[model samples]
Target: MAGATLLPLATAGATAQGTATLTDIAGRQVRARLPARRIVLGDGPLAYVVALLRPDDPFTPIVGWGDNFRSADLGGYLAYRQRFPTIDRIPTFRGSNVGAIDIELAISLEPDVVVLNLSSRAAAESSGLVARLARAGVPLAYVDFRTRMFENTRRSIEIMGEVLGEPVRAQSFLQFRQRQIDRVMAPLRDLGHRPSVMVERAAGLYDDCCLSYGDGNFGELVRAAGGDNLGSHWLHGTFGTLHSEQVIAADPEVILVTGADWRLYSPTGDWVNLGPGADPSEGHARLRRLMQRPAYRTLAAVRRGRVHAIWHPFYDNPYYFVALQKVAKWLHPERFATLDPDATFRELHARFLPVAYQPGYWLSLNTDS
Candidate 1:
């Protein structure tokens, strides 16, 4: 057989576009040559990368979601269902990791390529996933975007697209995201409305807001969404557990919570239970109740009814295009028309994403405000 085709890979680190050249979690050199058609996604972080690459495909192109309940982004996606209809039409997904991938099942499915995130790669490698997948005739590609940076995630998607023979769609999304981003961030018309913001994931422990982004992460989303995430003020590695008093003193006009633990699961109109542990909207409801309590009532978000539960990953993923629109409408109701982030998100989910039914996901707690 002819040797696999090779490209210069312009980047100093990229050995080839389709080769396993990148450092796998186990520190082994995993390289690919040109492209891979069959793919597997083992974790939620990869889901963000995939969802960003495309938004409304009828089925999850790759396979597996590591139990959607553990994912922080599902709540936001489910919340967004109300604003978009196409998302609801897509089909559900089912698959497992390489180690757990029923060899017979995967072989029956017949895929040339597969993917797993950096964090989970070590586990996959420790389990001898490489050899296992190879024996099954499936090539594995490992990637990570936990840092939550859009550029890196975009590059990751472009890499995936090239291997999957969908680079054009990936490029289209990259450009589409850039255009929307440029339009939203042109310049804040309401200079005075720049609200100091605080975002937290309500994990039951009020002090555990450490899930918050300090910098170079979802904090950037707050900026793009038209507010200042005070957490960005802290060093990237330093996340503060501010007291209720601190928040009151800061008096941020807005509070954005990662509502992933809420009861809402699917992104298709009105809230539906993602079943038992998969709910993220419940967490948001709880946070709202906390904000309205006596001690916290002094805070601005609750007082002014500016509290919002958001799918924060969009802040750093291709999904951020929808994130920006949501923030624009949330931050400046009078200055801007509702962007219908659900629509944009649905389109992205349908066009570039292989997953079906990701529309009508965003739910508002303080719509009257």
Candidate 2:
């Protein structure tokens, strides 16, 4: 919003033979040859959506990608690598963000199109990389799974599907996604009590008391699951920090912490390692230790053991509907007693992913509850 001015969809038109003009989530028109053979991922996690669209071989079209995936979600990375050993051979950039990308190297890959996160548009434009890529005839597309997630996820998936020549697969995944979402939202339409909730973004990854979302990402999931996101009242942007005192004052009814295997990023950090094939016993122990922090130790949520830790990557992926369903059940167990987020995730893997599904994505302090 601060840098490049995106053109409206109305201004975009058809392209010539062997090419298609697409309106990315950022409202920018990108003209790339159909079924891009060589793609560069500005953010590695985007491979999650790519996997959904190209179940047989998600990494085939990708020539290069960012390095965040290995460190951000190590378990998932390992799982995929196990199934596709060639993943390690793919060229990886140093940073996941657009600004940190080596534009010259990305262009050198001769990618048919480069997929970047919508949140990086300002940096991409400010650095003149967008214009340079245009000059090099490299189509650049924007997709969002983090900032403005709910509003842009569907369009972003559709854009990728078109780029990858898997529109039907994309539609199927979208329908599945919608069904999962409706499974949680439809019953909450006449909700009685919206639990006060706080989702600590990257909870134990940092030493800070609280880092959270506001009206977006996990915060949006909380609301969709029928909970009041306390961070929305303070932080104006999609992400920001909340003071410990403010958190104490809020006294949320439920506390949700986002976490992942951070050994690569923070070798000695106090974070919950939760992801594919993660150890629930160890994850539960970490969650218990994290709740001991002053900011949470005194909260009613902690006292009543209504605190839970969910995979941090869900805040930045299309699989968020699974998190939404899990959160819904946590917020209103009685209403969603039959809901099984784990089964839904398993089905997602069996139907669309190349890797097998593993159990340790979410853990609650009070498993019985």
Candidate 3:
């Protein structure tokens, strides 16, 4: 695909027309031509870009993207490929996770705008990626959905829309997302007690004891879902590991494990294979194994069958309302007795996703739990 034809957003020696200056998530002034016809999106933020810009034709402006879509979430990749067969025709650059980006290959694609996650800004700057891209005359836009989801996710989407010339559609998506969140939060506004929840971030992904989010991402999601996150109180930043004794000491009421089919990364890994089209039996079996871990086996939450598993990638994308709703239902079942997160997810797909909604994003031990 290296020889694939490039979009004519600009000629070799001339600047594109109708350039605009905007502030990116990194507080940097980025001057780029408006209505970017060629775009290079980071893998983690690719789902949001597609959903917001062209839910029906996501490959339209994508000239290059990281390989996480295939390596991290095979179920999601298959769904998109089924809808848009030509998706594979687009060029793929080296992923941003393991190593430095292939600057030469990215420049060869000639993308008008490159979208990256704000979490990687420090690495981009320290590695001189910013200077190199500037010299190459390629514009970069930083967006975030993980850190400070409430504050910065919308701004990132707005920035993307402004650059892509889809401000109206972007606003529409934002409104839809807010409504979803409100539906879950408004009803529980008056609840006096919050469930003490422990979120195990990406269990078995690294063969470690316990990893979790602290005061951000899943931690914030727990709060938004009317639950108290033990990680936020113990850890200092967004992500950290806790000793097994500490988790047992906290004795959270709900133990939510974030997992995915990480076989590509760790072939024999113990992480849960829970995503689109996953079988409940398989998911439950994996959850059972996770519960057997020494750190979890003796915990009250595990013994009482309050343990649950959710998709891991929800932390990376903007459309996290589904996770929030599910978490709310699990943490406060009586309060949100009538809430249906599965139906809400299907509704979201009907309104925005190009592909049909496939079940199995999350699973719990027993329905009555």
Q: Model 3 scores what on Cα lDDT?
A: 0.78
Q: Rank order by lDDT, top first? A: 2, 3, 1
**Position 84, candidate 3: lDDT:** 77
lDDT, each prediction: 0.52, 0.85, 0.78
From the highest TM-score down, the ranking of the candidates is 2, 3, 1
- Candidate 2, residues 1-369, lDDT tens digits: the string is 111222122111232227879998878778888778889998999989877776666787789999998979988898888878899999998866678788889899999999998888898899888999999999999999989778889998899878887777788889999999989978898998899998898878888879999998888889889999999999899899999889888999999998898889998877888898788787887888888888888989998989998999998899999999999999999999999998999888877776778788988987722
Ten-residue region with minimum lDDT total, candidate 3: 1-10
Q: Which regions of candidate 3 deviate over 4 angstroms?
A: 1-17
Best by TM-score: 2
Cα lDDT tens digits for candidate 3, 1-369: 111222222122232448889899889898887777788775534655665456645677788788777768767776777777887777775655523677777778888888888888887788777778899999998888878887887898888777777677677778988988998879887989888998998887777889998999999999999999999988899999888888988888999998776767778787878777877787788788888887889888887889899988888777788899999999988888988888887777766666777888998877412
- Among all windows of ten consecutive residues in candidate 2, which has the lowest summed lDDT? 2-11
Q: In candidate 1, which residue ranges exceed 4 Å CA deviation?
A: 1-30, 48-65, 68-114, 118-145, 189-193, 202-210, 238-241, 261-287, 293-295, 312-317, 349-360
TM-score (C-alpha, index-matched) for candidate 2:
0.94
Model 2, CA-based lDDT: 0.85
TM-score of each: 0.64, 0.94, 0.92
Per-residue lDDT over 146-254 for candidate 1, one digit per residue giving the tens place of the 0 to 100 score: 4545546566666666554456666776787787777676656545656787776442333332345665555666676677887776545423455555666777887
Q: Cα deviation in Å at residue 204, candidate 2?
A: 1.3
Off by over 4 Å in 2: 1-17
